[model samples]
Target: MANPNVKIWFFGGVNEIGGTKILIEDLGYDVCVFLDFGKSFSVEKQYYSYPNIPRSLDELIRINATPDASKMPVLQGLYTQSEITKLSQQKLLELEKSNQFKEEQESNIDAIVISHAHSDHYQYISLINRNIPIHISECGYNILKIRKWIERPSLTNNLFLLNVHTFKTGQSIHVGSLKIEPVHVDHSIPASYGFIIHTSGGTVVYTGDFRFHGHNPFLTYQFHDKILENEPIDVLLTEATHVTKSILSNEDEIGRKLQQAISATERLVIADFSDTDFDRFRSYYNTAKELGRSLVVTLRQSLILGALNICEGLATPNILKDETIKILIPKREDPTKPVTGERLSSWQKIYYQHLGAEVKGSVQSEDLWMPFKEMLAKMGTPPEEKLISHAQMLNKSREYVLCPSFNTIGDLQQVKPAAGSVYILSTSEPFDEEREIQFEKLLNWLELYGIPMLHVHVSGHVHP
Candidate 1:
């Protein structure tokens, strides 16, 4: 007989980027633990199929984020090629038929632990019968629930959701013979988690999506070392999101590069990165201040920042107005909106006075701050608007830090750098050849300008 306690199965994310199916056979209990079931949208869906988005309707049941068919160019479900979308429902059926995922009879399966709220990681969990106990960080749980605001409720809701459970950082519980500890880490999202599985084979770790830049990267190292010191080491699973050559660097290095670029560019120096990552947001602001530029985002970004502060036991990062560091958001659409530009700028005026840099060409200072001042100035703009920005530092045009930015490979190809700009890709390459075709298209564009590109990211999952 096979070793009763051995957890054996194909590690999905190992060979490719999606379908993270891990099987844990505990004394023949046959519990399969799934990490993620997301697909990288193909270039065809994102770029080529523009103006007319064709979502695989069958896939809607398997994933959330319902697209308004009435609305043109609305993309729901994780990004995938048109072809992939076609096969998604079929593939899921195959997996289920082959006993790759949970079935109704195996109620003894302990629980499903979701790391953060990324669709690639958690949306499929919704498709899984809600009856299986669901474990996740509070941040992820709320984000997942908030989908009602963007998509249909029933499209996401399932019967199994009734038993959902939330876990806080450093919390642990025993499920069957396995003890799982939810450890917190830094990611684009606020509450990403890594898990520690205690078993007879030894202690195993599954760090979902993590970075070392935030307040506690070293702390994560400590947790891993401490656990490894006491328990027998068997398998250490982590994401190699940044395993490419010198293409990817740790976030700290990225921060330093950002500072240099801001200082070098004498223009407006618009820096575009993730608004969700508190650390990145702070880093960008700090770099701007150091280089005599001000920081700014839309009103939506400001509100989200405030929300993040309330959830984590941390103070809102300060913006210096007088000292020259300023955070600006566009004006609110309606008069009754919660936060707006005028009110933010008036406060910013105080910081502007303090920094003295507000006086144009003055030396940069610290303390004086402003929030959303520019937005207040744009209050009277017309209803019709267009998306066009020539800033050298904008992120790859993503509305949110966690979701797919472009819909297809063709969409990515259209992005071109003017003579002297940089494109920093912070994740892994497409796992399949068909997906890589888009990469080829993107590379062709980069070659035109001899633009130097780098994959400045770190791993989110562990290697075999």
Candidate 2:
């Protein structure tokens, strides 16, 4: 019953957990749309690691990290002018010689619809041509913009000036012979969505990494009910990540476990979880409130929480207004001096200023800094007491439920945990060797401090 006019191609996300790229082409209308243009961690890891990534889009195409434009001539025009120029210079493709390349590097692909803001789902879009519009949920777009603002600038993260189009749940987008309607779904990250795509051939339901056990299970149920209304789905592209082996716990259970673990410790309680998992952040915040302790988070995480407030319906704590939450400012080379000079990045200075820190002279007047500054202004100024220094943290180890990642775990060297302190690993176990090595290093750090480790987590995926 497959419609001959509609051809579906799966360039990635076939046998891997991430790197999802699905192309839907309507031959009759001469329209092509990609469901998600994401990075393939598995394929990229085969050739490169961190600080050793591909030099150019040509390199990625050569290693099969991204779709090969050489094999698919239609994709040549879909790439950015700079990438195409580099490829042509390297003799990878002769698209530059064509007269069409002179006409703004027009794209055959109608659109690239992102399911969420997770790196695996939308990271690769940076390499594509900006002419091809990108459609993402309003919340997802804000999250990505904030992430790009905070992270170190790179070619791979050229998202500051993207031609992005943000939509809300139930908003339908038209892309020539197709209608893509994004429906909200419950996932570890906020603004996750599933698509009900209407094609000339048939209806395709693409479930983009969903679960029915998260804080917003009702959203998943609503997605299912929406799919039910669109019966006779010719194609069902679902995520079966946890079908074989799944965790049997929910957010409420994880929260209760967090409370129990923190309550048992009279000294410092260090919690480690994914930075963007706002639900998990809520759990830690509530636990700290219940235990009469302040929830201390890194400055980066505090900025993310502030940006997430742009999305309505997401109930993350207002860090600027929340008295129980505090922003943890790690010590610079000069512990006594305020964070300034070359020590702080551009976004870091902006964030510190937003938190009432004396970093006014460090901030620049560049246009790139304006959006973030304007956003912080709208969020209002955080209390000066909300900023906690590493020295202060060391002095008050017993009064905080500190949340730090492996990257920031070195802070423990300064604020050495007391005898009764405990470290809770609230994230999933390492799935690859690289992360396993990092986890082992983290364990070594804790063991050196004589702090016992406890694993208390619930998988983001649902139990099949």
Per-prediction TM-score, please?
Answer: 0.57, 0.92
What's the CA error at residue 116 for candidate 2, in Å?
Answer: 0.7
Candidate models: Cα lDDT each: 0.46, 0.78
Q: In model 2, where do residues sit more than 4 Å from their true spots?
A: 83-103, 333-337, 406-408
RMSD after Cα superposition, model 2: 4.9
Q: Give me the displacement of residue 462 in model 1, in angstroms.
A: 8.0
Question: Ten-residue segment with the worst summed lDDT in candidate 1?
Answer: 379-388
The lDDT of model 2 is: 0.78
lDDT digits (tens) for residues 1-464 of candidate 2: 38998888888888887899999887766779899988888888888877786777778888887887657855656678664323311121123223244326777788999998878889888788877889999888878878767765454665644568999885798897688889999988888999998888888899998888888999999999999999989999988777898677899998899888988877888888887788888888888888888988887777777677667865457878787788877665333456664767767777776676666355454444666688777666676588787667757777898887547466677667776789988888888887788789878988888899999887777668
Model 1 TM-score relative to the real fold: 0.57
Candidate 2 residue-wise lDDT at 378:
61
